[model samples]
Target chain A: SAVISQKPSRDICQRGTSLTIQCQVDSQVTMMFWYRQQPGQSLTLIATANQGSEATYESGFVIDKFPISRPNLTFSTLTVSNMSPEDSSIYLCSARVASGGRGIQYFGAGTRLSVL
Target chain B: AQRVTQPEKLLSVFKGAPVELKCNYSYSGSPELFWYVQYSRQRLQLLLRHISRESIKGFTADLNKGETSFHLKKPFAQEEDSAMYYCALSNSNSGYALNFGKGTSLLVTP
Candidate 1:
């Protein structure tokens, strides 16, 4: 299993301000994913970040709103732009590793963002 | 579109009692399912996956292709087992990104 570290475990931001969360993995991974969990809601995929390519955003998530950067295999960053109260949620970073011919994902502790 | 469903929002069980967490998924392709658990104040971790057919923390889940369900079960529930469990599905169609269900909060009391 791969260990993951996320910076800014918790943050408080004012409305209209932006915050970027960083995810660092111990080992190189092929794919990294970003997810958001709102209060009392399921984890929703924000985007898929691949090294050396553009990110693939999920249906309801747009790059403008949630920009992602995967500069390398071991690190990725997700930025919540133009933040609002609705954007306050827990953001998680996940990396996939191959095991038993299947891919298993490991997650970070998550960054809890509170926008006021 | 792939979707994972966990019917119960919360499940309470007494220590040493049997426990089951229900999960169902909808997908056209062969689905790969996983059970992830999040303890209080901890990161989400993988408990088990259907393909492995191995039990972790005395919990097991079997995938029923006909009924499209994968339910996690344990014969004896412990107080430490209380946590939020999420059912997820991943397939090639969605680029292998997990589609997670609304998690179920398990409460095991002494």
Candidate 2:
């Protein structure tokens, strides 16, 4: 399993302002994913970040609103553009690692975003 | 597509009692299942996976393919076991990310 670190652990921002969240993995991994956990809600996949290529956004999510960048195998960033109160949630990044002939996913601690 | 459903939002049990957290999933192809836990102020971590069939922290989950379910169970609940548990599923053939269910918050009292 890979260890992931995400920053800034938490933040408060005004509406219309954007925030970029960073996720770094201790080891190189092939696939990385971004997820959103709205308050009292289940975790939802936002996108899949592919190294050296544009990310694949999930349905109901758009590149214009939630842009993702995967500069390499171990690092990725997600930016929430034009923030709104509804966008406030805990954002997590996870990776799929090969273990015992299967893929196991591990997640970062998560970034708690609060929009006012 | 894969989807996981955890019916209980909260589950409470007294210490030394048996505990069970129900989970059901839907997927067209072979799927992998997992249980994840998040403790207060702690990061979400994997508790166990169906393939391994191993117990962690006295918790075990058996995959019932016929029922499309993987429910977590612990023989003797402890106060320290209280936490939020999420059931997740992923496709084995593709790189599709995990689909998680709404978590169940477990409370074990003395």
Candidate 3:
């Protein structure tokens, strides 16, 4: 199992501003993913960050709105640029590591952002 | 395109009653299926995966390929079992990224 730490468990941000959420893993991983969950909704994949390369975003998500940086195998950051009320949601960071004879993906506690 | 579907948005059962959360999927080929759960104050966590064929917290699921379903079931529901449940599918052929369902909110009342 992988231990992931995410900062700013909850925050209230004004619209038009940006916020960066950090994710740190206990060990190096091949894949790091960012997800978003709106209030009372399910999670949706935002992007995939692999160290030393550009992040691959899913359909409907763009790098301009959510830029990702993976400086190293164990650390990654997601910045929500030009926030809006629609961007108010729980952002989660997950990492995949080979463990217990299987590759498993574990998630962080998530950072809840309420954009006004 | 890969898609997951959770037919029910909400499922309620009394404590000690049986519970089942339905999940269906659409994929070109065989895919990995998993169940995830999230408590009110906790992060989303993996409950079990189809390949593992294991039961977690008395909950077990069987992947029926012909039926195209993986339903989560437990004989007795506990109040602690109340959580948001999601069904997900990941095909290694598709780069291991998961396609998740809309999710079902389970409420076990005492």
Candidate 4:
């Protein structure tokens, strides 16, 4: 398991503005992910951050809306572009690490974002 | 496609009482189940995974493949046990990411 640190625990942004959230892991990992939890909803996978390559996004999400960057093995950033009131949610960063042939994912504290 | 379902949105029980949070998932491949908990003002943490076959904080969940369910149970609920519990399914073949249920909010009143 790895410890993750996310910056700007909470932020308030206006519609059409964009905000970037940073995620740092204590240990290097192969797979890092970004997830969003809307109010009163379950967590949804936004994208998978790949080191030194473009990210892979889920069906409902797009790179233009939620751009992701994995600069290295231990750090990644997710930028929510063209923010809207509907984009308000808790954004969490997670990393998948291998342990004894098992893959386990640990999550960060999450960034609470509100788009006015 | 993989999907996880948690039927109850909120469950209230008195302290020392037995508790159970139901979870059901739909997946085409072999299923991997997990329970994640989030206490008030706390980060979400893993409670237990089906593969580990272990108990945490007096809670245990058995994977029932036939039923496509992994329900979390506790013989005696404690005040500290009250939290939002999420049931999730992992798709190993798909590479990364997890499918999470809506979650259950447990309330243990003393």
Against the reference, the lDDT scores of all candidates come to: 0.95, 0.93, 0.91, 0.92
Instruction: Tell me the tens digit of each residue's lDDT in model 4 across B46-101.
Output: 99989999999999999999999999999999999989999988876656577899
Which CAPRI level is candidate 2? Answer: high
Model 3 local distance difference test score: 0.91
Model 3 chain B, poorest ten-residue lDDT window? B90-99
- Stretches of model 1 off by over 4 angstroms after superposition: none
Least accurate 10 contiguous residues by lDDT in model 4 chain B: B90-99
Q: Model 4: runs farther than 4 Å from truth?
A: none
Error of 1 at A41 (Å): 1.3
Per-candidate TM equals 0.98, 0.97, 0.96, 0.97
Query: Model 3, B3-100: lDDT tens per residue?
Result: 89999999999999999999999987989898999999988899999989998999999999998999999999999999999999987765677678
lDDT of 2: 0.93
Model 3: per-residue lDDT, tens digit, A1-116?
88999998989999999999999999999889999999888889999898878999999999999999999999999999999999999999999887555566789999999999
DockQ of each: 0.94, 0.86, 0.74, 0.85
A69 Cα displacement, candidate 2 (Å): 0.5
Where does model 4 sit among the CAPRI classes? high
Tell me which of candidates 3 and 4 scores higher on TM-score.
4
The CAPRI-style docking tier of model 1 reads high
Q: Considering just chain B, what TM-score does every model have?
A: 0.98, 0.95, 0.97, 0.97
User: Model 1, A1-116: lDDT tens per residue?
Assistant: 99999999999999999999999999999899999999989899999998888999989999999999998889999999999999999999999999999899999999999999
Prediction RMSDs, each to the true structure: 0.7, 1.1, 1.3, 1.0
